[model samples]
Target: MKQYEYKFSFLPEAINDCEKVSDLETTCEVKGKYPCPCCCYNTFPVPKEDAIAYICPVCFWENDVFTSSDDEPSDENRGMTLNEGRRNYKILGACSQDMLIHVREPKSDEFPK
Candidate 1:
């Protein structure tokens, strides 16, 4: 059985460090002002060290944006403090065995006719 490893990032900076790929193998790219996953729409690479929270690009428009309190700007007029909302967005990824094996007996030569 072959095992595969998975890696994820939510920022452009982190994806930039990865070896440039042909947009085929799980990789990253820039789309407009946001970072996009080269392989899938639900996945994008983000800088693990970045302070700002990351949201999935595919769902960003539909979902409320999230930001960490530490990264939020200090302001008084802002209806709700940056810290008021959720700090981090959920990110999902997985890795597992990529191969399967099966055993079976050969078909019999007997004919129905």
Candidate 2:
């Protein structure tokens, strides 16, 4: 497993008089860009690999490599199916209705080459 690290910071005024540091870890295998199932945009990391909760910025679809079929319900995606997400992306500009606020329009560079 790969040991990923992350760092976080808090505003000095938000935490009163305290200082803290975190050594977060993970086994994420993010790599080169690939097509996102929901948006068909080449902005996803790790082609066909376990997505490890990477959310697509363009479509807000939670990546789940286990979701192989368009109609398959994805447990990692709040019981939403890929087809449902794709339909939502087409009409609402996001994978799900609620995700509209979290998603952004795909940039020209994000499209498949």
Could you report the Cα RMSD, in angstroms, for every candidate shown? 23.9, 12.7
lDDT of 2 by residue, 1-113 (tens): 99989555553434566555454344243333788878888777676475577788888888777877879999878999989999998998998888878776777777888
lDDT of 1 by residue, 1-113 (tens): 99999655765553456676675576443332323211123233343223143433332311113434433542321333323222212121211011112111112221111
Q: Give Cα distance to truth, residue 96, candidate 1, Å.
A: 36
TM-score for each model = 0.17, 0.67
Error of 1 at 88 (Å): 12
In model 2, the clashing pairs are: none
TM-score of 1: 0.17
> CA lDDT of 70 in candidate 1?
36
Number of the top-ranking candidate, with TM-score as the measure: 2
